[model samples]
Target: MVTTWFKKFMGKRLFDRYYKFEKMLPVFAIGDRFCVTHAEPKTHYSEKDIVNALVNREIIFNLTWTDNGQAEIGSVVRYLYDFFPDNQEARMFGGHRPIPISQNYLSRAGGKYIQIHNPSWYNIVYVRDMKDFLIYRDIFSILPLAERLAKKEEI
Candidate 1:
């Protein structure tokens, strides 16, 4: 109950902060600088899955781009949240899903803002029923690798 209300309140605030009417469409310039990546979860994945899969710990603190030595290249971040939220993540704002909260987490972790697109990583939409089970409503924030390690050093 309280969590739902808080989520809605924050969602409204975020919308007001980012929404803009430049032409016939709304624009939210995620950040001055951002990264992009694609998620290929065989099942309904969560924050941990994303962290384990995409974050290139071997790359040190590189947050902008990486050459994975695979087909993927450029505009990749050292963390998942560093990539701006997709249209679905944005549309699902105010929910308790990790993806929604992850977007907010990015901002708190010194990310400039968020971006919806990067030509380097074209958006790929997941079919509505990708997973059989319903994802539970819950808020989660996974800090970027760089920020997490920095906090540990501070301790």
Candidate 2:
């Protein structure tokens, strides 16, 4: 179907490289003081279950494709808290729904879950080490610098 056509268009070597890069992406990632995901899980899942789901296509789909509003933020925060009781300040970051640019970002469950999807938008979260982490769009922007780099690489 479309994938077959894309593979042909990209050539075998390019297609294989793209596929390998895609596979390297995680379904969900838990940092020392934060959790990042494409979207919220439909139900509470244990750390073990989440790790196992990384290899299960159906579970991966559920983790990445589920709608944002289905799960309550408080519940998700509570579930995460249970998993990492030591990190009381741990927060969850995810993006599936495109939040309004005017809104900037949406925080639910008392600012525990942050839903940010706008390509030009970003958020800074300060962690326990007094370090700040920037969470922005999942896709890289094709800005002038990126375009210049791409052209330079081509030459």
Clash count per candidate: 2, 0
Q: Which candidate is the best by lDDT?
A: 2
For model 1, how does the per-residue alpha-carbon lDDT over 86-112 read when each residue is reduced to its tens digit? Answer: 322321111111233124221222222
Please, what is the whole-model Cα lDDT of each candidate in the order they appear? 0.28, 0.67
Worst 10 residues of 2 by lDDT: 130-139
Q: Which 10 residues in a row give candidate 1 its minimum summed lDDT?
A: 88-97
Using TM-score as the measure, the top candidate is 2
Residues 44-151, model 2: lDDT tens digits = 677787788856777687677767577744666766687677766667777777777665567765677777665554433334431344434422233455567768
Q: Any runs in candidate 1 off by more than 4 Å, and if so which?
A: 1-64, 70-122, 132-155
| Candidate 1 lDDT score at position 17 | 51
